[model samples]
Target: MRKDSEHPFRQFENDPGRHALVELFVREHCGKIKDLLRDCVPLAKGSFGNILGIRGKAATALGLALKEYPRKYESVIAPFAEQQRLSVNIPSAPRIWGSDQADGKDYVIMDEIPGVNLWALPQLQELPRAARLRIFLDALGIVDQYRKAGKRHNDITPSNLGVDATGDMRSFDPDFMSDLHQSDTDRFENKSVGSPAYMAPEAVINLPAGRGPHSDSFSMGATLIAAITGEILPKLLGENGVNDYFFYMLNTEKMQREIDVMLHEIIKDPVLLKVLLRLLHTDPAQRTVEPELRSELESGAADHRTMRYILDDYSPAYRTAVQQWEERMGMAGEQEGFMRTWLRRTAISCEKLIEFFKGLRNV
Candidate 1:
C-alpha cells in the first residue's frame, strides 16, 4: 500500500493546469479526490500518461486502469477510444471502459489487462527455442489482428506488450494507433510519435507515404529482434546509431551489410532470418504481411532440419558423397564443423535441396 504522493498522478501537482485536470478527472469519473488519492495504485507510466489502477468501491467488477493525458492529445486519445469501441476482432487491444475530456486533460478508463510486461519477462535466451518461437509468433499475430482491422499501431515496442498466464501476447498503450483508411495528410501528421528504438525506417524520417501497415511490420520485426537478442537496435548500433541507420545510411549497401550482421548474431533459422530481413527492409513495400509470416513460421518447414532428417530424405550414396567431401576438406574443426559451415553459407541452399529431391521423386 503506497501513499497518495507516491502515485504517478502526483507528478503533475507542480503544474497548476494539469493538477486541476487531474483533480477534475478523479472527481468526475473516479470519485471524490480524497477517496481516489487514498485507494488508487500506480500501474504504469509513459511519456503520454500515468496509469493508475482503481480499487475498493471505485473499481469496476473487472477492475480498471485510469490513464490521464494532457488535453493537447485529445485529438489522438478521443479517436483511439472511438476506434476501440468499433473494433470487434482485436482482443489483444485494451478495451476502453470510458473516456472523457475536462479542464486541460483527457482521461481514459480501460480494463486492467492482467499480465507481466513482455520485456520484463525472463530473457529469451533462458527460454527454450520453441518458446522463443512461440513468443515471436504470438506477438506477430497481435500485429496481424491490427492489420486485418485496417489499423496500425505506430508504437509496437516490447514495453507496450504483455504475456498473460495462458501465454497469450497482448498489446496495450495504443496512444499512437493510426487508421490506414485516413488520408495521407492525416496519417503523416504524427508520423514521428513513436519509440525510436523500434520505429520503422520510414516513420523515423517522417516519410509521408511511408507510415502504413508495412511500417508496423518493420517495427514488429525490430521488436522481435530485441526480444530475441536482448539487444535493442539503437543500443546495438551505439549512440546516434538509430539516426544513422534510418536517415544517413538508409537504402545503401552498407545498411544492408549492417542488417545482415545484426541478423546473423542471433537468428540462425534460414526462413526466419529471411522473413525478418524483409520485415526490416528500408523499403516498406518490400516488407511481408504478418499473417503470411505467421503461417510460414507455424509450418514445420521453418524449423531447422537436423542431419538425420536430411539423411532420411536423401540417398545413402548422397550422404556418403557428402561425408567424403567433408573428409577431403578437413572441415571437422571444433569451432567450425562441415555441417555448421555449410548451413551458414547455404541459408537458401536447404530449400534448393528440397526442390531437387522433389524433382527426383517426381521423375
Candidate 2:
C-alpha cells in the first residue's frame, strides 16, 4: 500500500496555508459540502491533480479533485463541471457535488465512492466467478446509460472501475470523456486518449475508430476477461504476442475450439465464454453492442455459438491491414504459403505476447 507521506501531492503536506484555503472553500460552499477540514484524506493522484476524500455528514464519502496544475484552471475545471451536469443510472458515479476555484486552483467535489479500485483489491481472484461476471455486466450497464446520454467514457480499466462496499460496481473519472452528441469537427485531436492496456485494436492504431461506446465495449470485454481469469488482458496478450489479428481469428470455429481448450483449465460458463470472445472482435462496429447484438443478448442467444466468421465477411479495413502485414512478411520469405505465413505470424505474436506479459509482471 502507498503511504500518505509518499503521496505525490507533497505540496499540501504540513502546509497550513493550503489547509486554510480548503477551509475557506468549504466554509463558502457549506450548503453543498458538509465536511470539516480536519477529516480530509488524500485518496489518489492523477495526471492533473490530487483526489482528496472528505468525511461528510452523510453515510457515503465525498471526494474532491483539486486542481494542482501550474496554470490553466479553466481548462482543467470546465469539463468536470459540465460532466457533473449530466448523470448516469448508477447510484455512485459522476454524482458531482459542485465545483469551485480558490487560491489560484480549481476543485470539483464529488462522491468519494466506497471500496477500493478493482486492481488495488488484495484478493480479486478470491471473489466468486459469478461476482466477477456481475461486475462487468453492471459496468456495461453504466456504459450503456452514458452512451444513451450521448457521452463516451473513453477510459475503462480495472484501476478506473470501483467496487463499492456493497459489492456494486461504479464508474468514475470522466477525465477523457467526450460528448458524442457534438459534432466530429474536433475528433482528430482526440486520437489517443485512453489507457492502452484496455484500449481496443482500433484505438491502438487510430483514436477515431474507438471514439464511441463500442470502444468501451472492447475495453470492458478485456476487463471482464481479466476479472475471471485472474490475468490482466494486456499482460496476457502481450505475453502471448497476440495482436488484433489473433483476436480477429478467435471468431473462427476452429479458433474457438482452441480457446476452449486453453480456458478449460480456467472455470467459465459457455455463455459467458462466448460473450467474452465476442467482445474481442477486431472490428469496432461488430464488437460494439449494436441493435443486433443487443437483441441476441436479450433473446438469450449469447451462448448460441453459431456466429460464423468467414474470411470473406472480414472488414475491408482489417483485411487491408492484414494484407499489408502479410506482404511485409512475404519480403522475409517470398515463397511462404498463406497458411505458413499465418502460422509464422501467430507464432511471432505469441512470442511477443509472452515477453511483454513477463515484463509487465516484473514491473
Candidate 3:
C-alpha cells in the first residue's frame, strides 16, 4: 500500500536541484523506483548535478552511483552515527549509512538530511581560513575511511559542505549519479573526480590517484584561502589548466597569481604548508599523512589568534571545529542515550560544549 508521505522523504522535493536529477535518474538505475516521487521544487543546480529527496533505499541511489562500491560504501557509512558522536547541535536524523530501501538497482540507502541548505559559509569573506579549513579537515576523515575501504569522493568543494546554525559540519550532495554503471560494480573512478575550481593541479591531467588525499587536502587549502581571502587560483596552475602536466608544474607564471600569493603562504607555513604542498605535489607517492596533517595545523594554531576580531573569526568556530574534529576522529566520549532521533542531537553536543567552556571561565 502507498503509505501517506508522513516520512521526511516527502519533504525532499522542496530541496533545490533535486527535482531535475529525478527526471534524469530514470535511465541510470537498472529498474524503476517504487517510491511515488511527487514533483520536486527546483533550486539552482550545481555545476555538474542536481539534488533530490527520495524515500527508502532510493534516497542513496545518487550517492552510491558516484562510486561502484555498493557493499563497501555501505561499510564506510555504517560507522558514521557511532563515529560522528555529536552530543548537541547535530542534525535530527543519523545520516549514517543503513538500508531503508534500495531498488535492486541502487544497492544502498541513506537518510534524508533536513533543515536549511547549511551553505552560508561561502558568502562570508571575513570568515577565518582556519575555521573553514577545520571543516575540510573533518571532511578528510570521512574521505580517508572510504579510501582505506577503496572508495573515492567524486565531488569536493565549499558548496558540498553543510554547516548548521550551531556550526556543525556535515557532508551532503552525495549525488555523483554520473559514475554508476549498469553492469559495473566495485570501486572505480572512470569519471572525473570532484570539482574543478578547487581541483588539485594534477587533476587537470586526469590522473587516477592524482587528487587522492593530497588532492583533497590541496582543494581544502584552496577552499580555505578562497573563503578567507576572496581569491581563486587558476584551476590549472598555468598551461596545465589546459594540457601538459610536467610543464605546468615547472611554469613560474602559474605560481605568481594574485591568489597564489596568499596561497603560497599556506603552502609555505611550517605547520600548514606541508598539508597543502603534499596535495599539490605532482606525484601521488608524496602524499601528506592525514593525522600528521592536522597536527601540523595545530602547530600553526596561533595563526588564528590574529584574526579574533571578525564575526567569522575562529574564536568560537575554532572551539566547535575542534570538538567536531574530535567527534569525527572518535576521540570524544560516547553519550549515554544519544540516539540521533532528532537533528538537534548534533546541537546538543554543541550546547554541552558551550557549557563546558562557559564553566571554564569561573575556574
Q: Which stretches of candidate 1 lie over 4 Å from their true place?
A: 1-38, 57-61, 75-80, 181-184, 188-191, 205-210, 238-246, 289-296, 299-363
lDDT of 1 by residue, 1-363 (tens): 011112111121123333233233333554333444356677778558788776653242223566778877655443744555633357777656556554566667665654456566555555555555666667667777888877787788878886532235678777767775453348545434677778766664445655655778888888877876778876665536656656643554556577778788768876568778887787777886556666766764212223122321333432343333233223322222323343344223445445545655797
* For model 3, the run of ten residues with the poorest summed lDDT: 177-186
Q: What would the per-residue lDDT of candidate 3 be over residues 1-363, giving only the tens digit for each residue? A: 011112223233233333323323433332433442332222224333333444233333322122112333342232333322321112322232322234322222233332233244443334455654554455455445435433334455656655432333455544331111111122233444345566666555544434343455555555544544455444424333423433454343454343345456544434444555555444545555567667755543323223222223424543453344334323245332222222232222445445545655777
**lDDT of model 3 at position 75:** 28
Ranking by lDDT: 1, 2, 3
- The CA lDDT of each predicted structure is 0.58, 0.49, 0.39
Q: Candidate 2, which ten residues in sequence have the lowest lDDT sum?
A: 303-312
TM-score of each: 0.66, 0.57, 0.46
lDDT of 2 by residue, 1-363 (tens): 111112111222123433333333444465443233345556666446777655433211112333233245343222755666663343436455456555555566654443456565433345544444455456667678667767766677776776543334667676666676432225435443456567666554442344544777877777766765667664554334546544544345544454445544453565455566667665666665445544434454211011111111222332332243224333222432433433343322444445545655797
lDDT of 3: 0.39
RMSD of 2: 22.7
Off by over 4 Å in 3: 1-36, 39-49, 53-109, 114-119, 122-125, 128-133, 174-194, 204-214, 235-262, 265-274, 289-293, 296-363
